[model samples]
Target chain A: MLQKRIIVCLDVRDGKTTKGVKFKGNVDIGDPVLMAEEYYKQGVDELVFYDITASSEKRGIMIDIVKKVAEKIFIPFSVGGGIRTLSDMKQVILAGAEKVSVNSSAVKNPSIISEGAKHFGKQCIVVGMDVEMDFSKPSGYGIVINGGRTKVDLDALEWAKKIEKLGAGEIVLNSIDADGTKNGYEIKLTRMISESVGIPVVASGGAGTSMHLADVFNEGKADAALIASMVHIDGYTVGGIKEFLNKENIPVRI
Target chain B: MKIGILNYDAGNLKSVETALAHLGAKYFVSSDPYELAKSDKLIFPGVGEAQSSMKILKKRGLDIFLREYFKKGNPILGICLGCQIVLDSSEERNTKCVGLVPGNSKEFSHNMDLKIPHMGWNQVQSTNNHYIFKDIPNNSSFYFVHSYYPDPDNQNAVIALTDYGISFSSAFSVDNLVAVQFHPEKSGPHGLKLLDNFISKTQGV
Candidate 1:
């Protein structure tokens, strides 16, 4: 059976791993490359690094951090933030990152998703969607861009469908409202998009405990869960979380 | 021993290179048949769609070189796209591949109630005692990310099987040639061990 994945997210700013509460007031934690390798050693299934400052500062993801992580951690990892063009995707992949994610940039120009998928296989392309609850929107959720600083009028469900059609292999559904809240994943929103798309959906943001992951995977029907704070600062080990999920009958790589 | 990593316009070739460097093995990346011919063993690591990859292989004459190399009974290891293109045909782009293995690549059915690109880690069960799986335990999880899988016409060619809505061949072996649908280079410690086993097999251990 295909096991449900547990991905540890590292939000890197200026090469150091940082974590913010709902995308605000991020505190420097540690070195991203070191944190990545440590998480890999702790039996994490995959890793995702978001260059938090790239999009706002109008710069590329720190390639050196990517290269260092690749050399140390031998697992499938993705690099997101500040990826705008096909060349950016190429540079990240060639530097040894398995996948390149485009979130804010994909909203600005949807063609980059198709072009990246065409140039590199769709398997290497990931589309990250930062969504916030909005009763006014058709899907009851609106898409936000530029690291959640700018809210687009686009409906969340519609954007999810569009990106899958545009050749996005997977969708990382991050909830702005639930982000860093430590409550749980956006089950209603995550399940809505998961059922709507044919591609794999990774539920991101607001993972506080192992039970939360169990809820997302069982109730939300998420193929994977992207977590940060639970394991980053809450003193939860990736192995411990997977053990709990395994006990709960969720198939996780232990 | 010298190992040649076939570079015929595939994506993320650097991961394989770094894996080899980490193992302290002598390896080179080349599309030229002459350079690859000099290798004691060949590691075909690929990431892309089959149709375009096959086209590039034909243009660089790597398709012929690989076919001839397999005929000579030299050890060859195929990973991901490398594993699929070794088959005679593929459902992707209806591509006719290298024909080294008696099989064809197939796309997972959408009607099966599963994701298209089955990404992430899953258990790969060893079907038989092939030297390639030497020290690797049975049902060990490896990273996978593909919609299509290799289905060999000959059942004996299949060395391992995996389940994802359906049980399918995840690894195949034909004499000196072995191939797997998962990426060993990106699969962490166990994956590195698998690559080391491949190297040990080439050394006749």
Candidate 2:
């Protein structure tokens, strides 16, 4: 039995850790290196660093932060946000990110996924999808990009399948509506995407409690759960989630 | 003593280096035949297509060197693709392997319910108590991320088995050569312990 993974997401901006509610109302959290070390101590299975800064000046500085975090943390680290080209992906990978994720760039130029996969291997390319419920659409969920500010008008499930075909090793399915809500995971949306794709699906957003993690694993059938606020706010430790899942007979690293 | 890590231009070398450092073992990342032969032990770690990796090995003449080294009973450990390459051949690209183990690697087609790659932590059932898992607890979880696995025909070659879609060899040992499908570097404390065990065995501790 494969153990379920608990990943802590650190949204980095201007060389500092920050978090936003539903991709809005950004708030400063702390230093990325410090936050990453803390999460590593708390037994996080993996760490995700998403660079949210909107300035070109901060791009190089962000890679420096990734280098700092990767130097100390032994677990797998993934870096995303503003990764537009193969050079950008290579820089991050060279900076010590086990995987590099592309969102807007992969959507605009789908070949970037194939290119990155070719250069760094498919296992290192992660496709991030921000999805929202659209009542007019038959699939009900539409793809959102550009930090969840723009709608692509494509079905989220369809896009996930397409990216997998494009050679994305894994899919990080983030629910825009469920982001920062702390209610629970969007089971239907996650399940649809997970079932539609053959690769691994990581469910992100709305993980408020330990039960929420279990709910996503049980209902969504997600390979892993990505939590930012819950762990950031000290609502639950990664070890705590693993313990809870272990008690519930779910395989998780403790 | 510097442990030689086979640099075939693939896989997680840094994480493996970190794990070795945590175990307080000094190692060198090398592909040079002389450096590899001079090292105390060799670690062949990889994380990609077998055909591509074998191509690089052959291009560099590492294939002949590794085959000769294993025959001398020099300690060698292969992780994931590294482990698969020790077999007679792989279904991947229909390529021939080092043939150190009496088997061939094949893709898991028996179970569709279980996902391919078998990524994440899974427990291993030891076939026989070897020094490699001395301090590691039984039923301990180790990180694994691979699609195809080697099915060794010799029962003595298998030292551990892990249940995924089916019971498969997770670790195998035949004299000085040992290999595992899991990544001990990424598997937390248990992983560190496994590394410690390997180092202790290498040092004759």
Candidate 3:
């Protein structure tokens, strides 16, 4: 059976890993490459590096950072934020990243997902959606972009189906409300998207403990769990989390 | 020993290059059959669609070169789709592969109650002693992300197995042909150790 994945996200800005409270008022934490190496050494299943300012700054991805991390760690590493075109995807992939994640850019063009997927193959194209619970939207969650500052007409769940239909291989459903709260994942919302889409759904935000990771995999039916605050600042290690999850009868890559 | 890697505009080139560089090994990345043939060993590291990759290999004349090279008992290792391409055919786009083996690459059945692309780290168990698993512990987790796996005509060729709702050949070694569905370039420490084993075997060849 496919073991549940535990991914550590490195929010990078200007080559340094930064942590923001709900995507706002961030602070520099550590070096991106060093932190990635440490996490890799700690046995994290995968790594996601989001150039937090790349989309907002309207620039190409930071290829140097990606290369540095890729050289140090040998695992499935995905890069997102500010990826706008096929060339960007190619450059990132060629720099040693396994997958190129598209968030704000996918919403702005929509064709980026299809085009990127077509060019790089769907396995390399990951659609990262930042969602906020909103009754007005069709799926009860509104699509937010630009680090959750902009709202789009697309409903979260509907847009997820569209992204999958557009050939995106995987989805990172980040619950804006659960993000940075340290409470728990939005299990109900995650279950909805996980059940609806055929691709692997990575439930992000509000992962406070190993139990949260277990909940996302078992109850939420999520294929993977993306954690930030817990592992980032709460003194939780990837090894500790996996050990805890494995003890709880959860199938982890430990 | 020299390592020649086939690069057909695939994404695994740089990563494999990095891993080799870390091992302090001399290697070259090229598509020219002549240049790759000069090396002591070869690696066909790849990540992309089967159809386009085969088309590119054909245009570069490496497809014919590789089929003959491996058939002659030359040392070559194929990773992920690279391993799949060594097979006779692939379900992906119904493309004909290089056919290093008699089997075809099969798509994970949709009704298997499993994920299409089994993306993550899982334990791989080697059934017999092989050079690739030398000094590596059994049931070690390696990073794997793929939908299709090779169904080799010769079951004896399979040296390692991993289960993902179904048991398949995670890796196989036949004569001089070696291939793995898992990306050894991205499987962390154990992967590095496995690569070291391959490099050591090619030391005096």
Best by TM-score: 1
Interface RMSD of each: 0.9, 1.8, 1.4
Q: Which runs in model 2 stand beyond 4 Å of their true positions?
A: B202-205
In angstroms, the error of model 1 at A220 is: 0.5
Worst 10 residues of 2 chain A by lDDT: A67-76
Question: Quick one: best DockQ, which candidate?
Answer: 1
Candidate 2 lDDT, A1-254, residue by residue in tens? 77788889999889988888977788898988998888888888888999988898879989889877766777788999999998999888878788999998888999999998888888889999998999877789898889888988788777888998888888999999999999999999888888877788899999889999998999899999999988787567787888899898877877
* Predicted structure 1, TM vs. truth: 0.98
Weakest ten-residue segment in model 3 chain A by summed lDDT: A53-62
True contacts kept of 2: 0.41
- In candidate 3, the residue pairs with backbone N, CA or C atoms under 3 Å apart (3 or more residues apart, or in different chains) clash, namely none
Go through the candidates in order and give each one's C-alpha lDDT.
Answer: 0.91, 0.85, 0.87
* Candidate 1 lDDT (Cα, 0 to 1): 0.91
From the highest DockQ down, the ranking of the candidates is: 1, 3, 2
Give the TM-score (vs. native) of candidate 3: 0.96
- Rank candidates, lDDT, best first: 1, 3, 2
Which residue pairs clash within candidate 1? none
lDDT of 1 by residue, B121-164 (tens): 99999988887777888899999988899998999999999998
TM-score of each: 0.98, 0.95, 0.96
Order the numbered candidates by TM-score, best leading.
Answer: 1, 3, 2
